[model samples]
Target: MLDTTGANPFALSYNKLMDVALLLRKYLPHMVSFGMFARVTDITPKTVEELKNLHHLKLDSINIGIETAHDPTLERMSKGYYAFDILEQLSKLDEAGIRYNVFYLNGLGGKGNGVASAIATADVFNQLHPCIINIVSLTIFPESQLYQEVINGTYVEEPEIERLMEMRTLIDRLNIRVNLLGHHVSNTVPITGALPDDKAAILREFDKAITKFPEKELKAYRSRIWHL
Candidate 1:
């Protein structure tokens, strides 16, 4: 479920999604495949169980912008949820046999914490077995609070090369079988492959970025990106 407004769909009512699901199943019975973007904090055991009852509707896929499993980074960005919440909420989905794709915001922990962020995020993701881990490098726009933080010296954006290293670290530590989608517009290098199979090739690409590409070139590419 994609929300263009970036608001949590179930923020208002836990039953809202179920209500919609019922309508879809009744009116459009042919529509079986379904996916939606949802916040883990907004999902409950009841929501999963209720959806499971609708065996005819294939609402088995979900995309969650988990961002980072690092608590300090989550709080710094004001994500309104914590690491444990990710574990608890997602476990409900796992139990209900729902497949999910998650977003991993590279450089979310800022300059010094990039590696740590990757390790922490990978730890959480490994347990859940996400279908895809979408890797996006954090980009701070002028109007964003993060931009203000950067201006005020409260936060430091990760160096482009470091961001690549962070992504490599995440890939290296991931023990689960999942797709790593790094083709987002925010990424400097578009890398897409499955883990444990393309692991070596993926690491090679990251190594090339870290060694072959000049930092200035990567920075220039980043500067050209105005939005996510």
Candidate 2:
């Protein structure tokens, strides 16, 4: 229940006085038991410290959006920080002994650099070792810069199977253990598991479908799900 965007701007700033009256009146009862806290990025480092002061505040988890490990891809996507900067922030969070979840976008490196992006991302996650890693495929939204690229033929979306393969490959290479959650609407097949062990098996299942299943049968299966 961390609010990455809120008044305090950093998770550590949460305190009794910050918004005591309203929080107590509205959220305290439901949140107290689960240790809910919000993470606010887009704030200065100094402000981040102010937020960290609330460590005594009970929070089950904090979530942050790291986006991508490739700097160029992040720049193209107009994200605020570089890959190293994200790593540093995650390191700081780790040092504080705060559990966190990280969000990453798939197919962001487009065609040529997808593998590189995947590998770089795995390296970062392996280092940070967040409690959860949420892998999501890119969906073209009309207002986004990425959408413009797709419209102009500058960027192409990979087929669902290809995207799954890329993620599977990346997960296969990770050395650390973290829960992987891929339940976004853009993902054709939802996957959830801890790394290294389940990754290869899931990938193999998808590979079999892509390689052996007839297109007609696959379409029928997809159609049934869609209709249901």
lDDT of each: 0.81, 0.63
Best by TM-score: 1
Task: Report the Cα RMSD per candidate.
Answer: 2.5, 4.9
Q: Give the per-residue lDDT of model 1 (tens digit) for 1-228.
A: 321224455444646666766777777677756666787776754555664653235667778988999999999888889899998888877877777789888988998898988889889888887889998888889998889989999898999888988899999999989998999999987899998999999999889878999989999999999777
Model 2: per-residue Cα lDDT over 41-143, one tens digit each:
4322523454354333443356666767888888776776777877777776666555778777777777666677778888887888688888877665677
Poorest 10 consecutive residues by lDDT, candidate 1: 1-10
Candidate 1 segments exceeding 4 Å error: 1-7, 45-48, 54-56
**Pairs in clash, predicted candidate 1:** 1-35, 1-36, 1-37
Worst 10 residues of 2 by lDDT: 33-42
Give the distance in Å from residue 88's predicted Cα in candidate 1 to where it truly belongs.
1.3
Question: Best-fitting candidate, measured by lDDT?
Answer: 1
